[model samples]
Target: MSGGGAGASRSDARRNRALVLQAARSAFAEGGLVVTLEEIARRAGVGAGTVHRHFPSKERLFAAAVTDRIRLFADTAQDLSDVTEPGEVFFRFFASVARLATENRAVGEALETPELSAAGGAAGAGREFVAAFEVLLRRAQEAGAVRGDVVIEDVRTLLVGCLAMERRRVAAGDTTGVPGRMTALARDALRPGRTVTELPSAPRRRNSVECGVCGAPVAVARTGRPARYCGGACRQKAHRARRARAQGRNADAASAGRQRP
Candidate 1:
């Protein structure tokens, strides 16, 4: 073929691939892995043959879609490397990721999906994303912005919890910046606080009175003397033990008197 024709063909191929990937990402985000290649091609305004040329299988396409998203997240986190305040940079990046995951439920779900470990570049991209976050977390810890005891796993768990809260808010039709609110809460929750003194105090135990006889937890009596026993059986047992002790003491005293000269 002519030089111009070859160059034009290459450009068209790149355009088609971009279109397919864009469509696949949207489709996967909306419909998950159930979206077919034909549907993706249709959405991309390309022929099924073009999609197949770019991605031979659905799994590869799905993996590519997820990996591309992960690459975006990793890149964003790394972009904050020049920021002076580690805490500010980390929280900003976390908010961005939380918003993305909240909006695209399938993307977050796929990241945590164990079966996706075998997917093409998806697993590798996920690892890269984790490494990037770990770097940020380490920086924050070193700066004393994050607790030393907190690890990447704690951040991951907190993010997941924030996403869950976002989901709940969405389901309740209250999606007015829920992601930001949740991320802020999560960031505070993840701050330095390993000891009880550093952490928020636990809620007071309410109406917790131990049983007099069994030593089991019992409800505190609102009225009358504060309940010592859980029930009548326990009260009776306590009474019998008290009586037995008193009788033994009295018998010992009587025996001592009789032996006296």
Candidate 2:
């Protein structure tokens, strides 16, 4: 009947919208805004019209992806709140959040770009995450798993610092990773009578370099930190070309020396 047809259409619409969002999240995570809408449609196995109908523009799709991630974290926190191991759950949740934040390139891209705004739902999701986290913190404290003096604000700062340390390590080319260590350090501080690894010294600053191709100036951070090369992908391509040319010149020079001998 016509009534059943209308209901089926509504169900299909919801299904298509979910598909588009999933495709967008995966695509943006991999390639940021560089991934094309056509590619997302193909990934979702849906037509272009379905994607366009749900998200009229690529930016909107990106924003929606951000919103979806926020919701995911919030939902995860809510789910963990019910687990019986309240003491262990807090640290598990904390460590997982840190790991996810590192891999979440879309969120980083959104923060780096001024024009990319998150959808309205992101704010609400953030609030829900905070509330859920507070419950976890309280339960952990009640169970004597966490230090009584530690507050949610302290935990938030620790999480932020953990991410900052990770970026510094990456810039320094130390690939052993910082998050696990960061989580352990935080746990040592938060847990009752727990002693863990020593707190390491600050990360060393990398020396600022010329473009290594164009010899252009790189801007330093306002806090006196060394700056990475701007226009990175293009700069890297140019640097590789120069290296290739230099290698070719060295090979010819060796052949010439052999001929002279």
Candidate 3:
């Protein structure tokens, strides 16, 4: 009888915890991070003490929610890995995540915030998510369905940026089809044979942007110091060009001096 009672109690605890998590996710989505434990408990139909028992603080609770969502996404991606159509599976999962993030704006915001993202097992889950995502990306790349130049980080950035833009559209009262359009554009960008879209595009950067030597788009460093050249190769090339010009000018000056003498 005691064993059965213990089992039942554990089950109840698990159910209560899940309920609290679900309620907290909804509350955060609607009210941002300011939603109180009491409000979450009320929504979950549990007492505040129960919420506290499961999650010691609001940050922990939010962290748990973020990690839980990430794990679910990772699991889903793992399940889709065996599917024959790698490209389809990849884009479908991408679209699904964008839609999920769009619906749960709080999660999206949390993901964007570095401090919040690093809290409460979210980082661990992120590593796992990346591992799973890399599998899908690898399969697609091997199958020639996705461009070889793209990496897992690129996919993550693209999806997060899409969701962030969608959130901005909602905030600006232009929410219609933002998720869908952004996702479609992401899909198009990822397709094989398409020109790889560079990260931190023109809109996201400023300063003496274009590389003077290589003519490639130069990325503005986040730090105050901006990049002058695209890379080491360009810098070396420019150095050589300057040295050649200096030698030519010296030769011309010496020739003029000799003629005058």
**Number of the top candidate by lDDT?**
3
TM-score of 1: 0.62
lDDT by residue (tens digit), candidate 2, 1-261: 999999999999999999989989998887778889999999999999889999889988888888766677778888888778889999988888766765676764653442474456655666677688877886786566876446676677677666666656666787664446755666668786773533333333486554332233466666875654545643565667689999999999999999994
Worst 10-residue stretch by lDDT in candidate 3? 198-207
Candidate 1 lDDT by residue in tens digits, 1-261: 699999999999999999999998899888778788999999999999999999989888888888878878878778876678988788788888888877775576765563553477777778788889988986775565776445687688788888888777777877465346766776786666533334333334675676644444578766887877766756776788799999999999999999999
16: Cα error in model 2, Å: 6.4
Off by over 4 Å in 3: 1-19, 45-50, 114-124, 175-179, 196-261
Candidate 2 Cα deviation (angstroms), residue 17: 4.6
Question: Cα deviation of 204 in candidate 3 (Å)?
Answer: 24
Best by the TM-score measure: 1
Q: Cα lDDT of model 3 overall?
A: 0.78
lDDT of each: 0.76, 0.72, 0.78
Greater-TM-score candidate between 1 and 3: 1
C-alpha TM-scores of all predictions: 0.62, 0.52, 0.62
Sorted on TM-score, highest at the top, how do the candidates line up?
Answer: 1, 3, 2
Clashing pairs in 3: none
Candidate 2: segments with Cα more than 4 A from true spot: 1-19, 31-53, 56-59, 82-84, 107-120, 175-179, 192-261
